[model samples]
Target: MKIPFLGGRQALLDPTLVAPMSTAARPELTGGRRIGVLVQHGFTGNPASMRPWAQDLAERGYAVEMPLLPGHGTRWQDLNKVTWDDWVATVEGALDKLVAENDAVVAVGLSMGGALCLRLAADHGDDLAGIVVVNAAVDTLRKDVKLLPVLKHAVPAMPGIANDIKKPGADEHGYPMTPLRAAASMFAGYAELRRDLPRITIPVLFFRSAEDHVVDISSSRAINAGLSSKDFEERVLEDSYHVATLDHDAPRIFAESAEFIERVTREQQG
Candidate 1:
């Protein structure tokens, strides 16, 4: 099947866009590993945005895996056809890869990725080292989400995509339209995890954007207030919007994640 457009409105189909994971995208499995981190991306975003945060953790001597979820990266239509299980499986694979190599493993994700991380932690119970989510999607009611209750059940038109800042010299292709069922499934995944929030005992770091237009602020508050882990800490990024991972507030993400990693590896979860 033909791939979907990427961004900037072009029919670009570069292999570099959706090829298998680059070698650098996977963390090294050296014997001296400390913290193993699996980083997941948001709804329409590929692994590119999380690359910086992964690299930041790696530089701090922590292992990081930025997995590109199935159906993501190349085409939004591909994502529309995917199930939540497929997405969760992709993250599970990366998390296993990291935990297998390192002595300790902590899951970290941004946006939808954060939900994925939370799911893994809750499922594992006390087996996980920790989980940290930045601007996670607990309950997303975007200002633009009005009247969609009808469009959601009446007729399922494939929804369009949205983008924030992109890396320089990035290839341009149009975002494939989003399927409404896909959105519902992904939301259900977060909802299921949200219910288990009070059951998650691992350390969690919740970050929010004061001006985030993508994720709902109430959702962030709900996750912070609902988690069972008493070691949770919430930080609000004042300088960025929804896509704080790549926005100007990215440094805060790196710093917070680094601290989370340090604490997890040090067994500071008390």
Candidate 2:
């Protein structure tokens, strides 16, 4: 579909690149422990960004569910038609499925994916072992955001915020334009998310890029200040940008997250 604001050109969405992924747990690899993980991608992006991370966890004997959220993995214009609740419902369903089949479950998300994970943690803390969020955005400092209520009616989309990586060739395969109506919906829900932050009592591993063009430090500060989890740990990704999952520091994120998942799930089982 041709995005409205962008010139009349159809977005080239590769099916393989944006496909949802699922991997069953191999208990023998983890000494017969069944652990499941819900991995999620960001707004305007699809499972491609989290595929490697999900695969890494799956290789470590964890059941992984990397779902393509509603209004994503398709055209940017599709995103404009979906609400924040649609995105949340998709992740919640994925998490629910993982919880039913595993002894323990952890959620991992990037950017808006991170926000969705936090929401899951708030509502389903007892169902989750822990959560890992990379460059999760809960709030924005942009003055343009204030105009969204009026601007969304006038404009269909703005510039895209995908693929903010320091590594040269890495791509998240996200939409080229940011859907204004969807962006406003995501931003509007942040107030309630912030209010519910104190309900997330499970362990949280937060990763923040030292330099991110798309999301500033305000979000990290809000998260750090609002979370009620005593087990929260924040790590700085010095070498990457907002899309840290596919950037130079991606290996670090994958390794540390795996370790965190292992430890948290083991503790939950105990």
Candidate 3:
């Protein structure tokens, strides 16, 4: 089932063909120390999935930066050329810059973006004020996922996993295909983050969809089981799917995240 907007036309394959919603930056409010919020999108997805959430933060006077991950927001074939390290480096650099500019920084992410946020929290625990993750994917139960190492070489692409929202007419503007080699690299990153979850001591607000088709609830269970964060909180999204940020509960996620950022910033900076 191909959507009309994302037709399988050749024009959809070029990274430079159109401007991506990622890499957006909002200036800090005047005369006040603003909290910085860095929002990230999921694997095979672009900043389109994260824009509304980031925009809400910007409107609330927080400095916002949403970066397009390396090889993402482009053709799926492009993802084959990059490794997971490249993705992590892009996000890490953004987080570092946000930390340098603001009094506090909160990391917000969805799906694999959540995994990257966990990685940031683990490595840069002292620098982060808090974290918000929606439908974070830490592990997978697919039996075929085990064949990725070999399948990556054999299969270049697979069906896409974009627009997993319950809302109608919502588009995430993601790649139409899924790159196999890049997925293998993502899994490697997930495994490493799972091992380092104990290092993430910052406050976390985790959201999981009750009926997600892309990532299972077990992924959230694994993250909660491994996290050492004393301030960890989990909420089940009853009205959404994998892309809760763009679904029926988007407003709830945005409003709650803003509140979480405010509460954590006050507690930490006061």
Q: How many residue pairs clash in each candidate?
A: 3, 0, 0
- Per residue, candidate 2 scores C-alpha lDDT tens digits across 81-134 of 999999999998999899889989999999999999999999989999999999
CA deviation > 4 Å runs, candidate 1: 1-33, 142-161, 165-176, 268-270
**lDDT by residue for model 3 (27-138), tens:** 3441256688889898998887888887788778887778888887656778899988998898898888888787888999999999899989999988898999999998
lDDT scores of the candidates, listed in order: 0.68, 0.91, 0.84
* TM-scores for the candidates: 0.81, 0.96, 0.92
2 versus 3: better lDDT goes to: 2
Per residue, candidate 1 scores C-alpha lDDT tens digits across 1-270 of: 223443633253455543333232223433344566677777766666576777776676666677777767664556557768888888888877866676777788878888888888878745577887877886865643444445656645464444443333332232456656567678767667778888888788888888766677778777867888878888888877666777777887888777777767677434
Q: What is the lDDT of residue 203 in candidate 1?
A: 82
Worst 10 residues of 1 by lDDT: 165-174
Higher-scoring candidate on lDDT, 1 or 3: 3
Model 1, residue 99: distance off in Å is 1.8
Off by more than 4 A, model 3:
1-10, 13-31
Model 3 CA RMSD to the hidden true structure, in angstroms: 2.8
